[model samples]
Target: MNKKRLGPCVTFFPQPTTLVSTIAADGEVNVMTASWAGIVSKTPPTMAVSLHAGRKSYDNVKQSGEFVVNMVPASLAVEADYCGV
Candidate 1:
């Protein structure tokens, strides 16, 4: 087997798209589409999500210390795309 170098880049196939919902301390609700999330542990049933500091979802999570991750179906692709944007 031969391995070719492909320079530094992030490449992960079929990353699942999820909807993350959060509510701020002021009762402000926000939902954002995220692909940068995955399971980190199985025994404890833990998962991880990545969000930019400037994003509302990040702030909401910080303020509330909670969030909900929802799996998106193929039928809602259009809505998911809109949310991601």
Candidate 2:
């Protein structure tokens, strides 16, 4: 018997896209697309989303003290990509 060998995987993109919403203290809102997110504390319904520090959404989230994470559907991929920009 012969088995094909594949090298060890490094990174994968298996998560659904998300539109993270945040607002500044002055009520300015910002949204950004993210895939590096998952449940951290299920009982409390908390999750962590990764983003670069320079992003407006990051600043908004820190300033606002809260955020809304919206899941992106397959039908909305195009729009989601657009929204991230």
Candidate 3:
């Protein structure tokens, strides 16, 4: 077998996608498709999702300190893509 070195990078092929739903203090609901979410700890059963500061989801999470991470099923691929867009 042949091998080659590559530059520093992060890759999670076939990563599981998720729909993160959040509500603001004003009761405004928002849902965003996230591919950069995953379990960060096992003992504490913690998870993490990456969101930009300027995004509505980020604001909602920050304001309410609550969010739901829903797993994306194959049947909802279209809907998930729509949400991400």
Index of the highest-lDDT prediction? 1
* Angstrom error at residue 62, model 3: 1.0
Query: Candidate 2 — which pairs collide?
Result: none
Can you list the residue pairs that collide in candidate 3? none
Task: Indicate which candidate wins on TM-score.
Answer: 3
Per-prediction TM-score to the true structure, in the order listed: 0.81, 0.76, 0.82
Candidate 1, 1-85: lDDT as tens digits: 8998999998987867789999989887789998788889999998898988999999888888999998888888788888772
The residue-level lDDT of candidate 2 at 6 comes to 72
Tell me which residue pairs clash in candidate 1.
none
- Cα lDDT for residue 66, candidate 3: 88
lDDT of 1: 0.86
Clash count for each candidate, listed in order shown: 0, 0, 0
State in Å the error of residue 82, model 2.
0.9
Segments in model 1 whose C-alpha atoms lie over 4 Å from true places: 1-4, 7-9
Over 12-83, each residue of candidate 2 has an lDDT whose tens digit, in order, gives 868887888888887777888986888899898888888788988888877767889898888998989987
lDDT of each: 0.86, 0.83, 0.86
Alpha-carbon RMSD to native, per candidate: 2.8, 3.1, 2.1
